[model samples]
Target chain A: MTDPNKPASVARRTISTPLILTAILIALALIALASGSRPFNQTVIDIFLRVILVVGLYIFIGNSGVMSFGHIGFTCLGGYAAAWLTMPPMMKQTLLPGLPNWLMQLQLPYWAGALIAALWAALWAAVFGKILLRLSGIAASIATFAMLAMINTIYSNWESVTAATSSVVGIPIVRTIWPYLIAAILSVFIAWAHAISRAGLALRAARDEPTAAAASGVDITKERLIAFVISGAVMGMGGALFAHSIGVVTPDTFYLTLTFTSLSMLVVGGIGSLSGAVLGVVILSSLIQALRWLEAGVTVGSTTFGIPNGLQEITLGIVMIVILAFRPSGIMANSELIWPRARPEKPDEMSGTTPTQQGVTK
Target chain B: MQTLFDALSLGSLYALGALGIALIFGVMRLVNFAHGDVISFSVFALLWPSTDAVALVFAGDLPWFLLIPFVLLMGAGLSVLCELIIFRRFRGANPATMMIASFALGFVIRYFLLMLFSSRPKSISLLPALSQPVEILGARIPLLQVITIVATIAILFALTAFLKRTRFGLEMRAAAENFTMARMLGVRANRVIMGAFALSGALAAAIGLILASQTGTADIQMGGAVMLMAFIATVIGGLGSLPGAVLAGFLLGAASVVMQTLLPIDARPFRDAFVYGAVILVLIFRPQGLIAAPGTKERV
Candidate 1:
């Protein structure tokens, strides 16, 4: 068992995991840049944005062992916040006439808009988390999902403010990949920092051994709230970047499709480990890109053949099911990817208690 | 009178859906997110696969008696296939894993439908006779609405009697209460589970048929909104309580209809927001649900 009191070794291992993961991300970005294809660069940017979202998911889900379906609501909030702040004044006036005079008049830089978006998302997380974190297990999961539905419903129908289901465009488009790459790296570091923090360790301890942790005076709800707020902020930043990347924000975009995609990536990678979060994104995003290329058409000598449209999603679903059926704990299981020499002596200790064991014991 | 009838009719759909979800969750602790896709798949099974704008009706054109059973069988068949191929392997997996697997299964089913029919909603008129309005106690309502409410009540009673009096139903209830214990006592685990899946799938089909006939359209996503409401109903009712699931489903349906009628036209579109907000508040007050079942409580 990994002891929270053993800070020295835990801290050392934590630093290495984030460093190795960040290096891999940087290497992939460099390769994508070297490819010299605009579409490929866009794909790389998408992968980075996904990285931030999945890693943000990891901070709460991996540590707290709670499956939250509402975090994407924060992304919805963040995306709209970015769009509200960054869209030109004239466009905002016509598209979102419900905006107050100051917001209607103001247009901020991307970074500033993302900052406000993050804060806005975190604010809601704190409020919702206070009420939601009290419920544990399936109840908590359902509550979070309800929260998402509420957010989506409001955004989808509040016509003047959110443009009600229609896409709100005219935000500046960001084609460059560097900003996304940096944001992803920053998200990874933040997740790593949270994982090694007192609250994260307490939350994990509570997750793995709730009765014992509670006996030892761990406030499970408080730790969960902390993780929730931090993850909400990270998800918010990713959402803001997503708005800039696509040059449009819509309620449905942040609804079920995005929620499930980010979640599937996180779970397929390994829900319990940060390395799994990052690797899951890289592998799955690459698979999707490759599939899309085939769907567009693949050349064999002179003749061209293309996979039928919509086969990509079907294939992706099958792949995910196959993976989960075989490796229930996910590809990385619970262990972080580190240099072989840096791996701990006891493998089980590094991975902590597998979720299955915890499940059975509970 | 009109509002009361509308609420009952809408409630019938949700109640059926909640029952399907609750049954599976009781036995396996798995929240089958694919239940929605099962609904969609059953509806699409009525039409031949085509990219054309107009749906080519196949089984949908059958007489009402045959049509109902055909759709139910399709739902049961697909659901059973899913159990054999996918869910059976996840028997001992954690809840999160099982949930995600089911979700992936739903995704595959949904995309399969999308690929076949394209995303466009297909219009199909089924049981045109039932669409005509009938006066009942000074209120005018469609005959199909009356049938829906009556069918729901009949099914609920039949299910109740089956569980109370039949051997297989007894075994199912036993397994649901305590699967390992029931298994040790010689209940065939696989049989019981497969039966639950079959029943749940049939329920999904029933909902699909009603929705397809009432809306006069065979949209790929027709089942999604109802499924969501049903899932929430299952949660608010009690994880493993059948009666509670039914009751909560009705309550949710009534809540939705009431919101639709009472809210001003400007606020009508935001009705779902209020309903979901109420869901959060209910969860806060009753985390274990309104009627807690024996095995659902968390010790720690």
Candidate 2:
């Protein structure tokens, strides 16, 4: 619910920044749509889609300063939702012979199907977040972690519904630079808008100082629930975008490794701010891509000193450790990486608590 | 009949692991989420081949004497190492960071073990006496089950004494209850926390070895399943309460067994599911946990 008292100053502030950003994003999207499988174009699309995930993570993680080891679960939920919904009905029938009669009857187009999948992800999160969002710290984490494990096991074995959930082969190849590009821009928009929204402010308040937020009459539970659900829903949309792009979906893609990848992005990029999320995704995604290029690129002379793809994991792990040890606040900290001229303000009540308050302590 | 008994033994082992996790979370208030992997490291310490004659003196087909001490020592050492390295640094961070760290560290240790021990589950041999069945109430229960039950009782007794009787344990309790006050009173805070971590690690390792010996396989991923059980147990019992974890562990174990009994053959896959469901049920109704510290937190 939008606050009845919409601080009037926010409206008069500026349309130029939002318009300029939207314009730049549209141009980039057009370029992506025009380019067909160009190497750099692929990279550009990939970077933005990942930003969607970082931004999704930033919603709760940045505001709350809590670390979640299970955001990959949300991403996985999203990917599976999109892939399953968008499949050709005939292929869906053949692949999921055991799919219930109702699902077999419905055949939707890619975009509509993606929307449905995102809704499903949001719905699942709404159900789970009711229980999850109330508890702070480790209890919340453990509950969420349990959720991840249970879902993983269920999906791993619930083959009939998930096309052998372990593997979903033969997805219709509809992914392109455009979808990823759109998702990236949309993701940033949603993320930026959310941080300034009432729920976002309340969630941030609870995160910064639960005691103060609660004392000041912010419904911490409601704020967290909203953030948790929205975050999951956006990640789901990103996953749908990713599935359409990749043309295939597998449980392996959603394992602890991917979880580590996205998390490393959040950590290295910084967890407290939107710009950090964007920078983390762009920098880390490019780092991995550059490493891949290096591996495939020729040696300077006779001897090669190229790093192996497997070593990327080592690099990522090392980066997380270094970031935690040194600049855990992130380069942008809580600030956005690309800034608009003017900024937003908060309601009368915001807490001074650090990540320690909102974080999963156990 | 013996399989029925084996479940109880397994339950005891689960209880021990839960106790370990519960203790650390209770005291330092961090999840000690790497607990399962820490147990795995200790299991490797035991299963690691040793050529010395003294190694045989403890387990060389000699009987149960060496095995118990060896397991305990391995557990203690691994626990101490975890404290000094990963855990000690994350003391002041929020529960979220510590937990994320634990989850990450667990993976790191698991992968490292995968490199060393191969992900394959390995087993060790024990005495015929331990393996052989003992007839009880028309059901043949394995002697190992009896041993586990006895040992669990013994360990609990010793643990209670250590925590309730000894000054160090009191200091540890004080630190857990009120850190600043304890520190103001001249209690060495770091030393006590380190002790708690070491003890937690030791307990987890011992249980890990027992699990491997019973289940006939030691795998890098083994700790996670059990760790989840421990987490469930700790939550069911109470977040920072030891007795709660123990009670929850036994309840979870028994419930799983009974649940399997009630499950239709096809639904058995969801026995663990039901266990997790139970945890969720408990958590929703009682957020402070089954037996939270009196007056610690009261939600408005």
Candidate 3:
């Protein structure tokens, strides 16, 4: 989606960012596969899922410079959708008896279920986005959060169809993780393609300079709605995979905890940078894994070393604050993972004078 | 009539929370995610640190006079302490950074409480006398309910007067309206911000006391639902508008109570969905909020 007028070298560098990210993810997946350890594999899978979510979040929030508190709600929707489509007919008939007769009778392969889940979530995102995209800044964020709360409330109380607050079990757990890797990769490409697309550019323009963007004939709300639906689709796919990973779907699972976790990762990584989105997940997930290991105890020579059980969360919070204090824009600071030396030689790019490069530098 | 009182009491609680949020946002662009944790902390301060099922009453045993000030002071002190330690460094950072930072700070407060008190909801029979039934017109209400309504009105009047009549209140209002301009015009930024935090913290404490009395329990997560509703109210009221926040808070509370009463029994559990749906509608129709605070429109 890079503009055709852009010089070949710059385009290559822009393309390298996603390629590099994909390579890194592939390497991690291969490492997990090689280890053949279930826990480590699960840990890697968890990180991949987060990458998809944060990347999905970045598609809208990073580009639009709008903070969203509702993407997780779409994940909840997708999880239930996946559960509805993939669960054995017997289980659905017995547990979710209020499901329509056709839905109760039907079951699909995991991929088909995930695909449908993505569409189902995206379809609703369009519905909700039609209303929410009209607002911008903090008001928009709040509206999204309200949407999430509404979804959570309905899902939690709609007993027969959703199993209400109880976890819907029997999702075919895809423990092997290849599917998650593919999905995560898909999310990255989608985010990358959207970021460079005309809509993404206009949305970023509106974000950085709403007045100027509007003066230039950009339909800010329409552009924002586009990002909203795309990001919604990505979040829905991630949510489906999340359900399959755990073989359970519950409304609360897609509430504040996951919302904050992904948002924290996105912010700590850098809100405006794609590399930041992916790296945030990788770095934070690694830190969490390390903390878990310490909590379980580690041997140092003849003695065991361990932190208190609750210390991990405290440390994580403290680390987030410390990081934000030092690097307010995030670790990436709106920069991508392009070739490090490419900028110095390209004086124009180094100065970040070009309109296209403004997002990168800012 | 009972339903109306119920609505008013709930609205008052939300209004207080929104006021706390609005005060800080008026001075700084921060949404103060930690405000909820502060509420939980204030209530927890009354009890001796314990992981046991039963609370060990400490300051909680104080007569209402001393106890009230103690909890309020705890809230103010903690709010001020957070400002001094954490928020002070984030003065000019972007809104997203500050919001996330506040959230992280709240996370720390919540987990810290968890470490000391455990996640168990502790029971504390606060102001047992307030639980007695009282007559008001045709309505039989808890004395606490009436007290809550009266106390909220009193606080609102006092706040309005303070803002309207005092030099410091004038400075605070100016800062809320325009921080940089106020600072340029001789309002001390640090003092005004700190004052806002103190007032906000005290308000959180009031909420803590109210919640503790109403539920007869103190839970780590108790502040969450109210905090979310208050947050919504704050936004729909207009981000930095004090009176707007209060009015929206009350409206949301009423809407919630009414939905609970009017919805069919099967739909009653989905009351919050209806309320939130209404919130989205309000935002869509009037994104600047029910009362748009001047100069709040995004500049960039």
Cα DockQ of the candidate 3 complex: 0.81
TM-score for the A-chain in each candidate structure: 0.94, 0.84, 0.95
Q: Per-residue lDDT of B237-276 in model 2, one digit per residue for the tens?
A: 7777878778778877888888878789877876666767
lDDT of each: 0.90, 0.68, 0.91
DockQ of each: 0.83, 0.20, 0.81
Candidate 2 contains a number of clashing pairs equal to: 12
lDDT tens digits, residue span A268-303, model 2: 666776666777776777677776777676578887
lDDT of 2: 0.68
Each prediction's TM-score versus the true structure: 0.97, 0.83, 0.97
| Candidate 2 docking quality: incorrect, acceptable, medium or high | incorrect
Local accuracy of candidate 3 as per-residue lDDT tens digits, B201-277: 99999999999999999998888878999999999999999999999999999999999989999889998999999
lDDT of 1 at A66: 95
For model 1, the TM-score of its B chain against the native B chain is 0.98
Candidate 1 docking classification: high
Residue pairs with colliding backbones in model 1 are none
Could you give candidate 1's per-residue lDDT for residues B1-300 as a string of tens digits? 889888998999999999999999989999999999999999999999998888999888899889999999999999999999999999989988888889999999999999999999998898889999999998889999999999999999999998889999999899888899999999999999999999999999999999988999988888888888899899999898898899999999899999999999988888988898888889889998888878788865
